[model samples]
Target: MTTHPLLQALLPLVDDLSRELAEDERYRRLLGTLRALIPCDATALLRLDGEQLIPLAVDGLSPDTLGRRFAIAEHPRFAALLAQRTPTRFAADSELPDPYDGLVEEHVGHLEVHDCLGCPLFIDDRPWGLLTLDSLVPGSFAQNDLDNLEAFARLAAAAVKANQRLLGLARQAEAEQQLAARFREVAGQAGRAELIGQSAAHKRLLAEIDTVAGSDLTVLIEGETGVGKELVAQAIHARSPRARKLLVSINCAALPDQLVESELFGHVRGAFTGASGERSGKFELADGGTLLLDEVGELPLAVQAKLLRVLQSGQLQRLGSDREHRVDVRILAATNRDLAEEVRAGRFRADLYHRLSVYPLVVPPLRERGRDVLLLAGHFLEQSRARLHLRGLRLGGEAQAALLAHDWPGNVRELEHLLGRAALKALARQAERPRILSLEACDLDLAGTAAAAASSVVVAAEPPSAPLNGDLRQALDAYQRQLIQAALTRNADNWAATARELGVDRANLHRLAVRLGLK
Candidate 1:
């Protein structure tokens, strides 16, 4: 006896759903089969995380849609879907706005989605996530279509259950090896007061920190420069049982290579030329507490070997001393460089990298933190007002837009400095003591800097052909002249500001302007 065609097709899909394949590949194949089974313009598999639906696999949505997190409370269609267990279909003319409006990959400049079908997947009688099918044509799905989708949803649920079990087992093993009861105690503590932000990225970071704070595993905090790597270290120390003990910090990059060893581990008298008296290093001072190695990627090879020995046995000897002393300390390292790549490049040791990165925590960049930018800006504004003894300070609408639009390469530190500079600029221009000091877009100076950087790239990429046909020196001079002129215009003809924006000294800028016939 032969089975039905739909059942035959599903047999192979279930067989291929094994632990050997990657989870993302499994989701892609599952969504692909659903698309073939039920003809639709788009299909998406979303995982429910708290109140947000994170796109796991999207077949026909824009690339950016996968990066977006849809909040259930904000979208009526998602709320309606979650309200019931049965497959829910929305009418083409339904007043409720679609969560994925203007997000279809094929339909550019169009926001309306004609037909939508969504089904919630359940595991062990609990809601797990949703499987959605969308069509550009109105009234595309019929009653029978809903039945077919509901069948597919059952298979998807089973696959998700299997995947979750596998993941849970792996997590169990890792937790057993890396964590202890201390982690649970620290997990419940309110996070450090200095690290502020309520975005999803921020919350996720805090959660990761809390989970690992109780453990003695070495943690490597990685992120871009000025992304608050130090703040993360402080949070870990504050949450740990070692909070009462000292938290000693050392910046590897700040000290010379010859002195890095003495700074990290104590040195005895007569160890080096400058060793006047025996001194206790950061590691010794931080005994029974935590030690933070900031910019640890800059450690020399010789020091890295000694550091690895101490990490392994918790025993270290002072320079020029044979006696070894045992210390109890938790190691926390932070860096902006990719240590794995550094290890591969021969600049860092692989063994030390493995020793330090038992648990790695990443701090999210400022641009990815969403509306947290506004919150941080407001915080910085208040700080500036307090420091300057101003009556009041606030960002104008245009200034807020500029802050949101700019891609902050320097992260939180950059934002704070920019806000401080803008506040001072605004106060300088104010003739009277106003009730509220307002910072305008011009005061921020971000628009000019952003435009200048963008235009410089464009100008560099394609120079004028007419001028290039002349003397090579003249064409070079002309290009230089154009760049300076643009910077001058952006800075409103202020020579010092123009020089600063162009990254040249005021005297050098004046000399260049004269040589280029712009003086």
Candidate 2:
């Protein structure tokens, strides 16, 4: 029991604890001490990506759950932990909601945890992950105990960093082996696009995209707007061998008419009136990276010619430069138009189309993705509900059927807009729940929707054009007046019924109607 040389040598080890807490070796040794200090049945370290929280390490958990996500929405305790990103302790039957209820029942039944202490992990003062401890006994922690646990979190954060720096040098060999092990463990877990669908069309599209993602080939993503073509392009770039490099985007539709050429290819001094200095173009800036030409259908003809030159020769000459320069840049172009038709019509270059289409991926519209639509809808609803601080919100059975029944013409974009609108209305308590929350929840103005419904042909209702000669406010008011009048007439001027149907408050609808002089 007397002090010994080992105990004398342990002072630095104690001093070194903070930065070493998360390192594997240190974590194991400190695990029993942490549990005694905090007194818990289970404790876990969670890693986060954006709002996602996945389990990383833990005690008292079975081997199967080392790497699974516990979504914040589904776990109430965890949700509050995320919102505060600070340490908290819970007692059995506490007033606060227990968010992790279902996960516990499903994952570890009968091993009931009645108390918890949670602390967020942060790096650079920005949140990085979470540290959590749970217990099965009620009233296990007093106020001072909770305070002490938070202190432990602070110390743990320090140890995590220190050990990470030290063991990082020694981890190279171990990391490689672990990585190889995980690659096999997660073989098929890399689900397609994180956007699920089993349809033959969807499968084929996935296969083609995967085949081209490993290559340096140019890719053209073709699809309707809202079909997530850009995300697919991102997937290709991210999964490609070029993932470590940059991925830049340019919306051809958004380019300035006078500056498109100089923007795509560099500009030399005095290239034009405003060209005051030499500059590198997008292609050069994207050297060793990927350039995404979004809305390629909108590119002007002159610009298209220059673009063709770059694709054909891998060379670009600045606007006023006599010499040409070359850079290594991969092109990923996306369009929602029928480029083959454009090529036949001479609007697009056939050879350019061929080059860009070496790997063509058509993202099927959401309506065609079968069960994926419902999954997406549920996901969107949860996100919208949380963002609006509305809870227990969901699509009623009728609403769900209507959403699935309709052919989402605007695709995912329309669905997101509809869900967002319904969540807003839910915040106001206007509708019981969103039934797609009522097609009225969407961009389907009563008149336009009815008109479209009546027609066997689906006509793209040109959004009311921007007025050339009036204030934008006036244009908006005019559009509102038109929509309100149509809704009133369609519903025979019953304010409550109209308001209910349109997902707006009766008073607000009346006010809008009066403002628009629809009386």
Candidate 3:
């Protein structure tokens, strides 16, 4: 005894409900099986995203149809199909404009659909999306075909349900990992990055991170210098399903123009003068994980194009090699520069900028975090105390007041260094280490150090008196040189220390120094 043909066509979909599959693959298989059973010129599976219907898979239609979005209000045919739960077949002379007009493959010059059959898929008794089949021949779908489609629609809904359940399980696992990591951090594990704030701005940033971490969308983190943009990236990676994999970072601004491409996409042996051995770049190293492109705005135009290619195609080639290597990498880019302004100025690629900023996140500056400064200060103080091997370390009354009053131009990094310095100064004033060392306002020296550091101009340009002397660009360069020179002197010519003092990434500082001829 043989089972029915329709049941045979649907058996694979039932088998799929027990197995894991990519969402697109599942949808594609569903459409393929449906077309095999019911002949049609075109078919598509669309998922409802708000008021828009996004095509997840399409068959016998123009390839571009997968990219086209149909609004429910704009397409009356789609609206009619979604109005009911069961199958609906439109008449040959239906007055409504078909969304697929001029979209059927190989059919030239505005081919109008004559027959259209669609079933609104329901999950938990609510409208989820629609499955549609189109034919150029009129009266192509009969009552039996409609019944067959209605039966298939139930299996389609089950496939969607299974996909959703699998996704939920993955997210649940990632969430569990995030919670465990947080618990470990609170239990005094070292080297773990923490957000460390309770202010509204900080809370909002955390919420945004939580919302975007489950998916593989590229996130562009934008903020001022030392605003903990990298910390935000870490939080995102830690909460994602890729948390178990490595989280690699490359400072784009640190490398020279010639080396940036090699550092990102890698090179084969003897690819260049210095290429002695085959080396995998950050993209390859970060396979099945995350890559944080620090100072991504500083990437050169040529490198930007290649990077965009990798992102768009998920395929890359090493330098001087014809072979393409496929990688699965989730990108998290952080930049202190205004990338949109850079794009307008022709300094950054607009296409790359748009791709990277699919989910833009802005980290709030420390000044906007209100009393979270004190909390962060306390966190740093404990770390300082641990390093100094002191019994206890706490801020004095005046120190707390001074911290609240002053504007933190350098952001969190500045506060951290200030606390460390203040702790040392307070310790030196005593003959022996006290049981609890309290840092006073005088120990901070906020006013004096900030003013002196702000006034450095060792290379001798036009003084502050001549504000508009020479070109505006030259004046800006002169000021930047002065600032870098001063910070270098204060940091004992340590580029890394100077970067922290100036609240910039060390690689970014190096790029600025080179551009300003101060390197």
Candidate 4:
């Protein structure tokens, strides 16, 4: 292993630092110190959520992945680690598929990192996450380096706990601020006309919302993530007579289980440790407006019952109050999951389901939303350029085509992030001339000839948004993954040879294969 000065200084501090990982305030500095010690170009902390590894803390990496997920089945190497439940090493010539291929070229541009070691952080024999280190050079780690890696990984386990708590607090603060800002934006605009969409489906959705928006009907807006369900709810509230009142929306899935109820219903003084004064529940604050319960499917069963009571009756009792408070709030619920299945599974109340779905409106995914992707992408690009002052920048025809071709599993949210990165790169390009956005700039590796071909041309005019047809996306992805895996298995996981024949990134091929469950 190549040893550096930073490691020499940090080696003595491992045990001490590992102990301090439990300290919340020192979390970042702890990760920062380890990042410096490893001298990696980028270091990331992944926390296990069910069977997925979610990137939580990142240093010297793209912020686009502050909360990105990598499913356990997505990568063979990662799967192998999970299966064996042990630390493993993978070099450029390892037997497993490389997980970082497409992601590296399109985002980090790190071509090196030949020697990689990963260790699972276990709390009570359950995997928490893995600590990853990447250097700018290949073949950098040796067997002797395993000790330090394990030490750091253990420390990362504790750091993950501290980090999650810190992040939870940070999220609460940010939610309050953003919610305040949003409420301010739409205040006193109730009973106003809604800016309904021109499309048939959208118009119908708006009509349904309008009928309920005025009646304090608990609405359920169902759709895939990033499909503008929140926007639909906002339109409902804005057009309703409740425009003069507060519209409170919160993502039920985003909040930790322990804090969901507390966050929704305000606490009384001395209710808990942090309750220094009385606070108001969202229902009370949105008394005359609407409370959008985003991702309502994710609500814990314990909390779901309470939410149901609030939806049924127009009254709610705060955390510490025995006195029931009546509120004139309208409820608008949204979810990306199949609540029908949830209801069947007894995870959600059937009564609540029936009540909220009184005005169920589904928003189409970007790929199925005919021309909306481009409209939204263009809108996002404009927003990016306007916010960043990125001048003389345009998406190339190839990039547009690639954007159109993408399944957009992340939906509109993903497009916004891609445009933001592309805009940043366009700024770098403006030193010479008008910067044309391409798949590369968008941070899409544009793997496969289809992707590259789609991205290479110049677009003459603005194109239609939401061009794709349907859920055949999952089928297509499955087919492609099947082909790639067949070839890799035939070649015994020889990615370089496979890439040579298929003519794509050996890395990306692996990553895609992993995503497809082919790996």
**lDDT of each structure?**
0.77, 0.63, 0.80, 0.61
Q: Point out the worst 10-residue segment of candidate 4 by lDDT.
A: 453-462
Model 4 score (lDDT)? 0.61
Q: What would the TM-score be for candidate 2 when compared with the true structure?
A: 0.54
lDDT of 3 by residue, 273-390 (tens): 9899999999998999899999998899999999999999999999978999999999999998778867876879999999999999999989898877876876677567657866
Once superposed on the true structure, which residue ranges of model 2 sit more than 4 Å away at CA? Answer: 1-76, 79-201, 430-519
lDDT of 3: 0.80
| Candidate 3 Cα errors over 4 Å, as ranges | 1-190, 456-460, 464-519
The TM-score leader among the candidates is: 3
Deviation (Å) of 380 in candidate 1: 0.8
Model 4 spans with C-alpha error above 4 angstroms: 1-204, 210-214, 429-519
Tens digits of per-residue lDDT, candidate 1, 1-519, equal 989877875775688666556677888888888888888888999877557676778898654355455668766788888788989999899888766654555554344578999999988897878999998789998998898888888999998778767667345433432332343244343223357676789999988987998888899999877899998988787767786676788999899998998898889999999799998888899899899999998899999999999999999998878989899999999988778867876879999999999998989989899867876776676557557755345666677788887777568988888888888888888797654576789999985554443344223233443544565445556666677777677779887678667654354456457756888
lDDT of 4 by residue, 236-341 (tens): 7765666656778888878889778877887788787788999887777777777889888878888878877877776788887788888877788888767786
Number of the candidate with higher TM-score, 3 or 4:
3
Model 2: how far is 337 from its true place, Å? 1.0
Compute the lDDT of residue 497 as modeled in candidate 3. Answer: 63
Task: List TM-scores for all candidates, in order.
Answer: 0.53, 0.54, 0.56, 0.49
